[model samples]
Target: MAKNKGSSRKGLMLVVLLLVLALGAGGANLYVLWSQSGKTQASELEDMPAAEPVPEPPHYVALEPFTVNLQSSQYDDRLLYVVITLGVADEQSKQQIEDYRPHLRSRLLMLLGEQEDEALLASGGRQALAEKVLALFDEPFAERLTAPQVKEVLFTEFVIQ
Candidate 1:
């Protein structure tokens, strides 16, 4: 009976030892796989290209309101009231616009004087006028090599009467 008991105890000890070894091996394999996956994710992130930087918003230079007498033969009393805002490329361009404000205003008055009320009141006329204004400022200020970067001509207010 003692011999049978001793043999049974040894058998149980062997089964327990085998179970512990299997559990340890399984845990080690899981750890290695987890670490390898983490490294792969990190390497993939490093291989990816950097994201693009966001562009800056456009700078603006607002001109005071302009009131001009429109060209009309029949009515002889047509008028146009407009407020313009210039979208400049940079601070230097904005300063240039400011520096030449008076000359610009004079040129604008002359251009505005030639537009008929009917034409200005028509569809897309305001846009056409804006383009013309942009062209007027596209030239270089003074003797500078680069032109004043006037990107857009926006009309905040327009009235033809």
Candidate 2:
């Protein structure tokens, strides 16, 4: 009987200890959450740059023109310079593109920025790149516009920079 009592006391003590430890851990987590809760997210947002407004679709042709300078990766003398002009057919499509101009610009910049200098080595590569850009412009609003509406992607001035 004494041994049984001792075993029961030990078990009780163990349970109490476990409960205390669990409460302490939970309290610590709650404290951390409470302290962080007061920190304003708006201040963090204010530190970041404001997003650029999407240019509205223009009634007239608002030529979204771009020029990029890329050095040749294959040969030191080989360089690529390209100027592209995109002709949007209507105001709705124009507005859509304008609304997405910032995104479009970023995509174009990234594509151009990552171009291998060797990509300019051959005419085929340049043509391929032009096609890629054309495809990219159309991809963003593919569902929004019909085939005929997504009319033209023209490369005005293409030269080896």
Candidate 3:
């Protein structure tokens, strides 16, 4: 009877230990759920990233069409008809280009006149021409502009005859 009592006491101790562990696990789960509930929807929304602002469109200005005579070659005389446009960063840059339009146009015409027929005939030649024109526009305004104001020199109309 003493041995039977000892076995029953061991079983009761094992049961009590398991109950205590189960209760501890349940209490931990409840604690986690309660902590999550403390952050309301408004607080969660505040943690989210704000939306980005939309950017403004770029500005462009068109120059008058220019017709210039290229240096003569053995074959025939070459005449260039080019309509140029300038892409500027802002209103102030555009205004600066406009303010010095005469000087820019004169330089471009002189540059075009200096080019040989063979030199301005291919795709590479045309790209070179645009770059040169952009340089002409940028050089005069180098003091005022933080960067080159002339972003691009686009030829809206280009014809060689």
Candidate 4:
């Protein structure tokens, strides 16, 4: 009977110790949460750049559609037609593109006319061509005007047949 009583007391002490440890952990967690609650996110946002007045879309200039004959060395001739919209960074760049329109158009036409069907018909070829055209806009002009920053060359209509 004495041994049984001692065992029961030990079990109770063990349970009390466990409860105390759990309560300490919970209190520590609550302390952490309380500290975080005091810090408002609004205070941090003031230091960051304002995201307000959401930006408008980048301006663009629509170039005349291009139609080129791509005569394949491997197969039948395929005609390529692409409708392009060149993204200009700002009003100044737009004006630059308009000013040099004749020279720009001629350069683009020559580039397109030279592409053979075997190359243009490939899956990634059209995208590669678009990148090349974008690079062309950055080339130097006779006036030494600021290069037309062409952010993107969107092919609104692409057809190969």
Per-prediction CA RMSD (Å) = 4.3, 17.5, 9.3, 13.0
In the range 9-123, model 3's lDDT, one tens digit per residue, is 9999999999999999999999988878776666888988887788768889899999988886655778989898888888877887787778678888899889877878866
Output the better candidate (3/4) by TM-score: 3
TM-score of 3: 0.65
The candidate 2 region of ten consecutive residues with least summed lDDT is 58-67
How many clashing residue pairs appear in each of the predictions shown? Answer: 0, 6, 0, 0
- What C-alpha lDDT do the candidate models reach, one value each? 0.87, 0.66, 0.82, 0.84
Local error of candidate 4 at 65, Å?
A: 1.1
Q: Report the candidate with higher TM-score, 2 versus 3.
A: 3
Q: Count clashing pairs, candidate 1.
A: 0
Model 2, span 1-161: residue lDDT tens: 99999999999999999999999999999998877765656577888899999975634333445555565545655444556666666766667776666776777777876677666555587777767776775455446554323455566766655
- TM-scores, one per candidate: 0.71, 0.44, 0.65, 0.63
Model 1 C-alpha lDDT per residue in residues 1-161, reported as the tens digit of each score: 99999999999999999999999999999999999999999999999998889887889998999999998867969889999988989988888778888878888999998898877777988888888888887676667447789888888998887
Find the candidate with the highest lDDT and give its number.
1
Error of 4 at 85 (Å): 0.5
- Which of the predicted structures, 1 or 4, would earn the higher TM-score when compared with the native? 1
Residue 32's lDDT in candidate 1: 100
Higher-scoring candidate on lDDT, 2 or 4 = 4
Clash pairs, candidate 3, are none
- For candidate 4, the per-residue lDDT at 138 reads 64
Please give the distance, in angstroms, between residue 8's alpha carbon in candidate 3 and its true position after superposition.
Answer: 56
